[model samples]
Target: MILTYAKTLMFLLMSYAMAETEVGENDLNEVSDQVYGVKINKCCELNEIMVDSVCRLAELLNQSMWEPQFKTEDGIAAALKYFNYVTGVPDCATTQQRPIFDLGKSEDELNLLTDGRLQHLIHHLHSSDQIKDDPLITNTYSIHEAIAIPEVKEPSSYIHDQAKYCMDKIIITSSNITGQYALVCVPEVIINWKETSFLMKKILNPLFHAIAMVLYLLVAIIYFVIPTLRDLAGNIITTINICLIVSQAADLVRIFTELSNHVSFMVTDIILYISLLGAFFWLNSFGFYIWKTFKSRNVFLRVTDVRKYCYYSSVVWFAVGVMAAMAICAHFLLDSGSNPYKKMRLSNTIILEDIEQETIGWLGIAVFFTPVAFTIIFNLFFYVTTLKVIKRINIYGRIHYKLKGCFDLFLQIFLIMTTAWLFLLLSWLNFDGLFYAHIVVNLLQAILIFYVCVVRQSHVTFLLRKSCCYAEPIPTGEWGDEMTHMNGGNY
Candidate 1:
């Protein structure tokens, strides 16, 4: 559904170019400005028509949803209106004609687009690369650039609002400086991701709650989840450190807004990418750890070494750690000023998209499959080595329940959401399509995080809290007391 709309938008944009050439009665107009008077008069007429149409559509869409209106629908409809306007659909005053008024000399004829005007403006901008990319018109970059330009002298003000409030301030101050060829994206990706995450989280709670109860019961037997005993802690810590670095890289964005230098922002992007490499390693580590716990026969999850992969399966974490002791000796110092976004295909580190992104995507699939392979291997061992052990062992019952508790399909939603985000990021990096995928993933990730967080709180929280707590240490591989009791079917 979404891709179809995108192609249709692209086709319409190309059609507009052809339409502009043929629309003149003599078929000889060289520029949009060659035909004028109707620009002002028709712009007004189209504005009025669209506002009226949207107000009516608003009422209809609201009625269909059975309420005054939904915030989500309103946002989508508004965006759709802007998209429609940017493309300059037929009969829009914008399509018929548009006026470029001089701010210094002419009366301000640019009426801020209301819903009706939105359709005309967005359609024009969407189809006309000239309109959308022009910094003076509606480009996303112009705003990004403006945000980098600073007015407030206070340091705290810069850090707090950079992501949210700062962008708006920059736009208002930017006025006419926004150049053409700047709008990088529209919010198509932003809307869809938000909805699906909400839907998944809503459905996963009951099983999670049941699982958590089982985990709390198992706490008397298991000392801890196996992943935390060794390298996994370091991996999680590394993930956190990279996040801190990314937060630090964020300073360059502020510097850009303050000085209006695009270079600083570019540097910041470099740092972000470098940091993401670290982040991805830890995330993969955590994902694999969780996979192990869910599938392990002993009900204790152990972290496996990811080394010995076919290719760049992430070797940097260990190499970097080995060199960390040299930091005090002037080796491997922090490159606070260094741009991490600088793309490189280092021989050792596995990049997801090393001209071989498609090949690496398979590794992600393999990362997913490692547990399935482990499950088969372990289940067979459990049958041969531990099946009779269970008959004699009461604690063995806890093992069965907690193992089931740890791995739920409910948990996969987070992995799925992250995978989608990763694909979107890779695609954007490759410049396949923009706006649609990123926006969807960003919005989806947010919703997924919230849903997953809540589900974790309600269901898995018990498992995590029980494991992390200092209540007491217990035996490693036996069936938990709770599991043994539950074997009596008490649960």
Candidate 2:
């Protein structure tokens, strides 16, 4: 009886244990099903959110382009928020809230948004036929690219950085999903109202500069070869041409190479200043010489010594050099860990900085351009005085001679210096006319110099006439007082 009872007890214990095991297995299966269902639902919800976010972004971008008063920063911020929410990344606002212009806030915002995944999203959006076809979408995308994209050394590395950086920003939750990635790019923007004028300037400025440089070089070479061409005017013109050539050559280098260092920035800055200051100085010298020539006509009756010319030239060069040096020194002293010349790229056939801060802010402007401003004022005064003298002489006698001289002088002033002043004014006012005027006038500076000093000169005409067998050798005496004054006199 005792053995039978023990067997029954053992059998009951085994049966109960087996039943508990079955129940536990069933509970586990049910829990797994619930978990899987939750995952699918969450993923579906995320998909819906992403789709909605994308559509909203597209709408915001379109609105930004269409609405003239739309704040681009606000639009970008809103788009970024939506993008973050959909991508399982925290919104920039939640992470750090501040104004758009706040440097630290801006940097943080950019870091949060610029992950590889966002870049991938941008690439996909940009490549869509619908987005490409829509002008509003295209322009908005361009603005984002300009403001958001970071420079990377390698294309593949950009992708890797994007992925790694984005992952760092995100928490590795069980529900998260990884996606394919690609790079993004933005096209430059153009306003429809000013498109024609801007485009013309963009195309013509470089073309004209190249043509002018070649012409100046050829003319300078000719002046060097011909003994008769060697004079005070010729020497000044040659120096001006050399400065211009160096400046233009630097400009070309900027177009080809990305100048990211302080040395290149300083060199480019110096070269540009020298070109501009040198040209204005020489123009002023011409005006001064003309005024002096007319004033001393009867009293002095002779050209100023070449030594005086050299002295004047040295003074101008030294002054410009000082200004350039000051600008460089200021940049070094007031660096503030933010350089004005950084991440420069070739754009519209010119080297342009992606971000341009004043060299030392306002101080830089004051130091660099004060002398140029004074020079411009003095040149203008000289020009007016010379014109008045020419008019006075014409009233007394030599009407034809005075008229020819006045016309030549007028052309010289207009081409060399007047246009540059006009550019400054128009640029300050942000006038649309500046686009065409600046390109045409500034790029053709060398050509204008050539015309004033060589093509219009009587000596050149006589030489050309003789060489071409178009006329016999005219006696130097019969060439008129204008030619004699221009050749023998310093004016």
Candidate 3:
């Protein structure tokens, strides 16, 4: 709505306070070739000049119909602004570009746009408050609009400030980054909710699959695998680690064990599609540390630094878990819906997808680099310290003070874990799924830890065993016997 037509439609709508006609659909086609030029009229009775002809003249003569325009972040933003304005709804959050934009193709090109055109469209959005603002047209994620978000858990009333849903939801079952750089993002996205329900009736959630009480007891005892070392292995590093591993493993087994019943669930084959660069770095360093330890023979790890790493990783991981748990709790407790309990069951994975997509490159850089900068500084201090200790204390010293292997082993794990964190950065870049990337690295970490504890330890133990074996044979003949003979000769 423009002020130049103020005497006409403006008076009708405002003074009359309720008139609704402005550029009727019937007249839209015939109304104008007059956007920027002189025009003849189909409505000949009214044509002194349609007067709105030429943008400049219309503005100059107090007869403007259209507002000015400018660019926003993307062309989609511009489209969203105009559409939301027209439709009276909010904007949509978009997906992470899968580098698909880099390819050359026709549809791939920016939609038949002239340079600097969107800039013109966006300028108008800021200038006028009186014009009808469309929700679809300007999806500036200002936390106020009412477009549907993934869960629709928070029902914000403003159409423009609402949230959008993730097309595919996956609840990350495990975010383990301890062992082999492994993490698993388990999909709890329930696109196939009906099928899941039907199957649950038959299989009964696997843990409680048996219907009869006796059968339930028997089944639970038998298949439940009752938490053991065999179940945990060296892979479960902490309580958090154990919980994550079991939960994800159970989730996977539940889905698969009840495959026919829950067949409709659309799960990502994360193992296949995802890359584990984190695990790669962890393993690469694991091998390096092992080679150094075995060849140098005097290497050992310190326990203090191990405690420190464990403490911090646990704290950070715990906080992340708590935040996630609280969010789920809040959604369930706060929703005014009649069945919040039922809704909490899914705990939607689609939210992660939306987050993964919406986060831009700059944020990605910050997330990756912040930990990275800290890790580098930490590692530099330890590395220089280690070298200083070596030069000063001297491993080859005759006293044979015993804590050497322990110290080196501790340092080995420290260097491996700290240096390997960058694996996550590279992993995020390569694999879109963070959970799976963690799994890959964590698995490698397991392999490394085992190799360090077993293989490296075995070599040291083997050396000790040999030394023990030679104790009897080497004693007098080597040094003591020679000294005795010399004394005899001297006497």
Candidate 4:
């Protein structure tokens, strides 16, 4: 009952105050005409004076009803000051031999009366505060007086289209560089609680990438420590591990940098792309090595040719580096002719474009993807050839169980990579649902490799036993060609 009474009392007080302080249309019209010599009872002619009249009327309304206190003289001066600052009115240009104001039809031609200029001129009015040392408008009545105005209860509609145009133009213009460049042109993408993919991108993706980096490092260390593990397969796996580490490190750096520094961010991105492409090329080497082994019909011999592997690695690395450099150059130089808003350089004015967006150009997307596409194609070809050779081996003499295990490991790695790439393609096509899956598959690759190549093998335990002097020494013939083909054999 007490709360209801308080509400009723407040409503009555507000109504009384509004009725006392309300400024009628006649008063505003009088002020407008007095200032601009144009009546505001109806829309006037579309000319300079009419525009000034509308702007002056808006300023009067804003000062009387929205401000802390009504000041007709001050409002008139402020409006005139703003108009002069923006339009340079009453000042004749020597070149044109007339007023500096150009009432041009095109937005570009009317440079002085642009929306950007108007917004900038009146940006200070966005804030409302008590007058620190004022005789008329004190702290107590300042807040209440503005609210008590009738316009606060019901919005004041403009009867004239010109007046509406005046308010509309000023209200929509941005007050800051971020608003003009980032917020205004781009369509906002709101990620709510339901958007699990965005959350995964923010948190889970980095966590998994870190975990995978550690796992890859551990596997690489294991391969290096175990002398018997340093075979053809070991060298290739170590290269793959290094590539994964570089790629993950680059990605993690890129994620945390907030994209504030353009040069460092671009460099990280370049490293990431090159490392990823290199890893896939190494995967292609997997099928190539396996297919070569089977086709030679030398099942008993392990091809641990260091020189051959070095040559292949050098070629792959050099090719990947060249392609990446070319792609980066092409991306910046070529123009895709996409939507101007989509492109980084929205205008010739460099201040208006986002730094990150400007650095990452759109045209070289296909050029960069070209190497990935080629690697995937070759990966498929090598896998198919390896599978055919495997079928032939199965039909004839029985293959060693250890060799088949190595092949299975290779196949798992290949599938993981291919599936991750496919998911990336889908996500690129705007399949938002697959975004989390893409991140998970791409980031957890090293974890799977560590599990299969290190944890699943008895090599680490065998080495530990040997170091502690608690295991029987291996027979001389046992560490022969067959053992080399095992990759990581059970002790």
Give the alpha-carbon lDDT of every model: 0.31, 0.45, 0.30, 0.50
Rate residue 215 of model 4 by lDDT. 87
Give me candidate 2's TM-score against the actual structure: 0.52
Give residue 343's lDDT in candidate 3 (0 to 100).
12
lDDT of 2 by residue, 1-491 (tens): 99999999999999999999999999897776545421100111222222211322324222221111111322243221112222332222211111111011111122123221322122111233332343332211222233333453222111112212212111111223212111122122323434454355444556776876787786677555444445455555566677667766654444322232223544665566667667667666665665566666562332334686688688778877788778767666764444342232223332122322122333454566677677677767766776677667633434245334544644474456556655744653545577567667666666776787667776665555554565555334332334545554442
Residue 171 miss distance in model 3 (angstroms) = 30
Q: In angstroms, how far off is 96's CA in candidate 2?
A: 30
Task: Tell me how candidate 1 scores on lDDT.
Answer: 0.31
Which scores higher on TM-score, 2 or 3?
Answer: 2
lDDT of 3 by residue, 183-281 (tens): 112223334344534344223333331222232232223212222111111122232223323333333432342232232221212221111212222
Per-residue accuracy of model 4 over 1-491 as CA lDDT, tens digit each = 99999999999999987876665655776676556542111122222122222333444334221111111322232222211111222111111111011111101111112111211111112123322122222211122222223333332111111111111121111211000100111112233534454467657878888888998898877666566666667677788888888988997875542333223655676787788888888877866777676677566654466786887788888888887878787765554343211112111222112222223344555566677788778767776777776676644432345455557667887777777667766765545467667777766666677877777666555665665576555322334324533444546
TM-score of each: 0.28, 0.52, 0.27, 0.54
Candidate with more favorable, higher TM-score: 3 or 4: 4
Candidate 1: segments with Cα more than 4 A from true spot = 1-263, 290-316, 319-406, 409-414, 417-423, 426-433, 460-491
**Winner by TM-score between candidate 4 and candidate 2:** 4
Q: What's model 3's overall lDDT?
A: 0.30
The runs of at least 3 residues in candidate 2 whose Cα sits more than 4 Å from the true structure, single-residue gaps closed, are 1-204, 256-263, 297-305, 334-339, 342-362, 394-407, 424-437, 465-491
Residue 79, candidate 4: how far off, in angstroms?
6.8
TM-score attained by model 3:
0.27
